[model samples]
Target: MSHSRFESIGAYLPSKRVTTEELVSQLQETPEFDLERITGVKERRFRDTTPENGEDSFALALKAVQDCLSRSQYAAEDLDVIISCSITRSKDRTKMYMEPSFAGAIARTLGAREDTISFDLSNACAGMMSGVYILDRMIRSGAVKRGIVVSGEAITPIAETAVNEISSKYDLQFASLTVGDSGAAVVLDESVDESDRIHYIELTTASEFSHLCLGMPSDKTAGVALYTDNRKMHNEARFLLWTDTQRNFMEEQGLTFKDEGFDYIIHHQFGAAAIPYMNAIAEREFGHPMPPDLNVIEKYGNTSSTSHFIVLHDQLSQQSIPTGSKVLMIPAASGVVGGFLSTTISSLKV
Candidate 1:
């Protein structure tokens, strides 16, 4: 049975970083809301928008791919597949791209061969993981040998809209202010052994809660926007998404929290408090608490599709997470789509 593993990882954060204090200063007209206190995001990187040295999503993705390639064994033409999972494609900063696939364009720029299967996948913030899920299945089925999943999210437009248009604390677009911009890439190849291999990947959607969060152009501001019903979506029901999707699988495999022996839990970096809240809920429902939670929300904010990967990269870079560590990841997306990922790594290089 052929399985896949993340052979290498890469991430790119723009040089322009905005502290929560700076963000607050930008919205001086609006009443104060302690952003850091609310979302646990002290600062977040933003793609340079300066004309002389700015980067579109495509450029950011390219840089991330270069970073990935530097740490990988494969060259440009060696990849069997290249998946682009960015939610935003800033072709010219005025429009989001959709005609030719961003993945295809990225591959072309990278000098990848024509034989490479280049495509794009979007599933809200679950976009990158969705690509991982597909590539994992393909590798297991012997349809492909190597692949790369990458994403570049320039989500600050929504934050710009929210800062200028928000009139009161009750505005639905409050969540938009917490997002940042970043690019991430992961290289996957057929596994040689148990170490550094992906164990499980799946995505479950609760469409019933789909209406709770939305991203669109702002009616009041010039930039894009996001509106979220925090009261309804963050309640007990949304947190139950993981359990509802996994009960059957867990029953069949006789897997419990303690039984899985996950050394660390890296949930989507939506917010610092939300993860701990999830841990408490899991303990109440599953009869065992989750493992120690790893996060980077304090510095990186929510990089959307790149959230979990950012945490992985940060931990691995610092050597805080040793090889053979049993890692469990949960992805949180606005479509109310989410799932768990398990992996063990013998060594994490970049």
Candidate 2:
């Protein structure tokens, strides 16, 4: 049996910056709370929208994969599978694509083999983690040798919609204001030793809260929009889903949270304030002091499915997370999804 490890990592963040002040200034309704202080999102990046040389979702994913390949031991043709997990599939500027999967297009453009398995998977903000889970299972099952789990979120259009449609502080599109655009990818291959391998990866969806957040066409205008009942989505009940599931899993494995020895914990970058609160809850439930929380929401905001990898790549680039560190990644996605992925990373670099 083989274990999968994050072999290499890559990311692409747009050079364009949009400050929270600028973003909120465009809102028709004045906010009662300090958007920047509450969300800790001072600024975020926007993809280049130039018609001639724009960076759409597909383009961003391609760039990220190319970057990943540059640092990876494998070339495009060496990948056994390519998983594209973007929530937004914008290709030709604003045009969305449904046929010819983003994974398929990405693999073809990168000159991968004709038999290369390419597909798209959607699980809200947990998309990339879900891809990693699948690829890890494939590697462990002797189904595949190497694969890439990637996401390119050109998701700022929801912010544009929130700016135009928000009529009150409690509006459904309020959470849309916290999104940014980014692309991230990670190469996974068989691990040679216990120092670099996934300990366990699991996910479960709480379908009851699936309606708490949704991305759909605007109800009031002619653009894409994201509606989230922020109050319900971030409540104590929702946070408990993660703690309880993880606690039970650890118990079943005859281990305690402390036994995992996570050097750092990466939660879904949903909010700056909510993350701390969630960590507090986790500490109380697990009876252990949680690891230092890692985040990039202050600069990149929430990049949807790409948020986790973006933070990982950023920290690795700055050398904040040292090699051979045990990392715990928890996913909090819109399907009311909750899961934990524990891994010891050694060779993953950005």
Candidate 3:
């Protein structure tokens, strides 16, 4: 049976990089600020040139998709599916939903056929993985020959708000300053040779933990109340707390603390603080130290769903791993955790 394979991957980071010092300087000038700690985040990328109003997630997806098509030999007309997976959206103050429909706008921007499959998947940080799995099933069923999964996460605004709120409430300075912005894209197709395609994908969920990390719509009433009560800010710490659950899931996958059966490991970036713990767990389970370069947390920060693809794109561009290498792409979303094991097939060279 033919299998779905990732043919190419691409990523785009905004030209404007805002360092912690710069952010602190700006914040200090305001009445609500004071001395702060930036933790380990050196800087984060922001769009150098934005639309008159602003560049939303859809626009970011378009630019990244264009780059993907240019780097690979694929033409716009050859694409059979387009999936826009992002946590952010474009909307007006009065409008309830984002304008232009993310999937439709991306399809038009890429000159894809009207009949081509197009849609948006909002799975928080696991959106891209969900999109990939959906497309994989379609290709396996002969519904489409080629598909693209794109994510444009301009989480800076939310991060900014979350950080400010967290800092104001808890008197903590480092956590809010570590968030960053990024975008990424991936191209998948049916592989004529099963040897070069996605081999296995396992997904598990802990819905009981769904409330751990959440983004509630802003409410004037609650906003005013939260300003005085610090307890509300504690939810922001959910990302850190979720690490224990992720470790448990990894163990269940038979990926013991030190197993090295997999040649490459790509995971969602949570920041420098989380990397050492994950690396240590992998080493303990695998019985060997993970390569220093295995971590991408330092540069990109935490990009939610785009984190894994960003690392994959970087590794592929550098040819860091040889063809036929076995790589594991792992991502742990707020309520769900997923593991995808794929082989770097020889066909990827062509």
Could you arrange the candidates by lDDT from highest to lowest? 2, 1, 3
The C-alpha local distance difference test score for the whole of candidate 2 amounts to 0.91
Residue range 112-181, candidate 2, lDDT tens digits: 9999999999888999999999999999999999999999999999998899889886688878888999
Per-residue accuracy of model 3 over 108-160 as CA lDDT, tens digit each:
86788878888888887888888888888888888889989998877666545
Ranking by TM-score: 2, 1, 3
Q: Judged by lDDT against the true structure, how good is candidate 3?
A: 0.63
Question: Which candidate has the top score in lDDT?
Answer: 2
Q: What is the C-alpha lDDT of each candidate?
A: 0.84, 0.91, 0.63
TM-score of each candidate?
A: 0.96, 0.98, 0.77
Winning candidate number (TM-score): 2
Report the error of model 2 at residue 2, Å.
Answer: 1.6
TM value for model 3: 0.77
* Clash numbers, per candidate: 0, 0, 11
Ten residues in sequence with the least summed lDDT for candidate 1: 26-35
RMSD of each: 1.5, 0.9, 5.2
